[model samples]
Target: MIEILKPTELPLARETGALVAGILQTLKARSVVGTNLLDIDRQAQAMIAEAGALSCYVDYAPSFGRGPFGHYICTSVNDAVLHGLPFDYELADGDLLSLDLAVSLGGIVADSAISFVVGDSPQPESVALIDATERALRAAIAAAGPGVHIGDLSHAIGKVLNAAGYEVNTEFGGHGVGSTMHQDPHVSNIGRPGRGYRLRPGLLLALEPWVMADTAKLVTDADGWTLRSATGCRTSHSEHTIAITDDGAEIMTLPKG
Candidate 1:
């Protein structure tokens, strides 16, 4: 379902987006060497509850994942990428971690993700992978605006990843998001320009650009939710929920001071 926010509904969306961004920023800052994934989830729950918000993940059960995700946030480390279910593992120095979060506040939902290296140790490959995804996300956002095709955003993102020498995986990509966590108008990471759905004011889209270092193939972990690189290569993912407006695309998930 494609949900277009009326002018009156936009304020709530902005609030939800701010909350999502703030939680992600808080989680990213708290994640470090020896940090337990479960602890991170707990932190997210606390923040959501304190803000009178609802978690889009806690009871989320989709066909591709195990029923009732039963978590507050997605903690993807190293090889893990999408739908990363929080586990009992503790992060180590230099571990590549991606925090994906979504929350509903005032009846509107917002989603976002960030990839970073944990602790003081920084691995060159990990940094490169994260940087590439961030760059691709930026490119995709830049390509978004009124009348822009979904494929235009995809092409922009794909070009950045391809140029960086990483394989693009389209199995799971961005999508429309609003009142619910996930919605229609699937946005692939790679495609031809001037195709697919056309952008319009008040439309909200979550544009995520993710890539694997070596291959485009993915393998589901035993947990049935975590998606990892088939070759065990490091991966990275970046995402943001954007609202199309008359001026251009407004990034609703940016952190607020």
Candidate 2:
């Protein structure tokens, strides 16, 4: 379902977005060599609870995933990209990691994701992949505005990824978010401009652009949730929850001080 937030709902959304961003920033800072994935999830849970917020992932069970995600955050490392279920694994230096988070505060939901390298390895390919996704995410956000179509955002994102020599995957992309986690208006990573749903004030969209290094194909992990690159190449994902306003698109998921 597509949800348009009223002016009053936007404040709650901003709060939720700030919480998601703050948690991600905190996790990014703490995720280093020897950091356990489960520990990261534990930290996220504590932060959410302390803020009196709710996790959108803990009990999330969709058709593509195992029942009850049972995790506070998604910790996708190296080849893993989307729906990364946290498990017993310690991060190693130079491991490409992606943290995707969502939370509900004051009855509104916000979602965001970030990709980074763990520790000091600084692999060039990994950095490039992460940079591409971040650039694509920015391009998509720039394209978002009143009267803009969803495809415009997708096209803007796809161009950046394609130019960076990465293949785009449409299987899973961004979507609408509001009082609930996932909503309608599937925002693909690639599409034609001037098509799909038109943007309007008060609309909230989670625009994500993710790409695998070599191929667009994906393989599901044995856990039935983690999505990995078919070629086992490194991957990256960047996302933000944006709210449409009269001036333009307001990015809600920015790290809070």
**Candidate topping lDDT:** 2
Model 1: CA > 4 A from native: none
Error of 2 at 167 (Å): 0.9
**Candidate 2 vs. true structure, TM-score:** 0.99
* Clashes (N, CA, C under 3 Å) per candidate: 0, 0
Candidate 2, 202-249: lDDT as tens digits: 999999999999999999999999999999999999999999998789
Summing lDDT over every window of 10 consecutive residues in candidate 2, give the lowest-scoring window.
7-16
lDDT string, candidate 1, 1-257, tens digits: 88888988888888899999999998888997899999999999999999999999999999989868999999999999998999999999999999999889988989999999999998999999999999999998888899999999999999999999988888999999888989989999999999999998999999899988899999999888999999998999899999999878889999997
Q: What is the alpha-carbon lDDT for the whole of candidate 2? A: 0.94
Model 2 spans with C-alpha error above 4 angstroms: none
Worst 10 residues of 1 by lDDT: 3-12
